[model samples]
Target: MKSLVTAIQQRDGRALQAMSNSVPLQQAQPVREHTAQVFNELFKQLRATFPASMANFKDQEDLNEFKRQWTKAFAENNIRTIDQINAGMKIARQQENPFLPAPGQFIQWCKQGESLAVGLPDEDQLYELYREYCKMRGWREMKWPSNACYWMVTKIYSEMRSKSLTDSEVIKLCAKELRSMTARIKSGETIPAPVKQIPQLYIPTSKERSLEHLASIRKKLNLNPKSI
Candidate 1:
């Protein structure tokens, strides 16, 4: 009986059936009742939301089988939260596609919805972060308000050091990095989180830019090398 409940929680059908076969009818009744409650509540909401998509489920037996299978799928995929369900529903409404998405598709949509953290700081905030990075020469670290900010500023620091970029060039590159990182985040890629690193304090000499390379960058920025 204990194993039966464990199997039910795991959505392990084979184990559940074997346990139920051994247990008395009264012993399995509670598990059956809970499964029914979840099934009825879960699919009714989905069915009502996308009735057109469920048109193929007109056969009662097939529909019941699908509900059973979907219950397992939801449990396996860890889609148990009200927030996750609502997020998937929200993504469904936003999609340009009129047809209801496949179960796997909806699962990914739920993930994307949850990725939208509240009040991600503006991309322009990278400017300040880049300035902060410029102040240190050793392997120091600091916090960023958002993932996008950390990524953009990291790029800014790397390019500034390796390319021997001027102030104007660094500013332009920082802006470009910010735009690119922000777009990637919007597209549902799990970019790195901005956890503040513990300072290591190791410093290394930076590579010098060739005169020709510096000249080219100045030209791109419409500045003459002779002006400096």
Candidate 2:
């Protein structure tokens, strides 16, 4: 159960649902503890192999075995789930795979608004791989406005970009996300912003400090600062 919640945080719906099913109905708390124990064991095994693909786990013996088997398969197949995740990163020069956004244009803007979302890489070379994943899981698609991608892109840029993102760039992204959101949601749309947590620290005005006020205070106090 705990592992299910953790998977949800990581946005692993399949893992979440599977974890939930593994829990016994009557023994909820005990089942949760067992699940956690199993999850931890599984996590440890996967951590050694396909670290990126390993979702959260509860600490339970049964869960551990499950994780171990999954990890073994992943390792044997050289299926680097983390690499796939990295491929979805926002700042990539490559195009997003057509299969990733799965439902694609069908996903309504009103449904997701402008918010952060995740999907597989858009690389055409991975067409076969994408198709396989889609055939199995149906692309794990979500409907979100550009804001979802913007958040991902900015985060990726921050992590990998040679140059840091400017306030203007971030604002532009925000604006673009808003535009995408509006375009997607028609009137009577109940869609909310994808990233409801307003970017507090990224606002452009926050970067500029007021030196003039400091200078005036220094003059009034008769204290000469070493540098302006």
- Residues 150-179, candidate 2: write the lDDT tens digits: 343434344334555564554444444444
Residue 132 deviation, candidate 1, in Å? 18
Q: In model 1, what are the clashing residue pairs, if there are any?
A: none
- The 10 consecutive residues of candidate 1 with the worst lDDT sum are 115-124
Task: Quote the positional error of residue 35 for candidate 1 in Å.
Answer: 7.2
lDDT of 2: 0.41
Off by over 4 Å in 2: 1-145, 162-228
Q: Compose the digit string of candidate 1's lDDT tens values, residues 11-129.
A: 99999776667667777566555555655665666677777877876698988787677656665665666566676777677777756677677765655455443324333455677
Q: Which residue window of length 10 is worst by lDDT in model 2?
A: 102-111
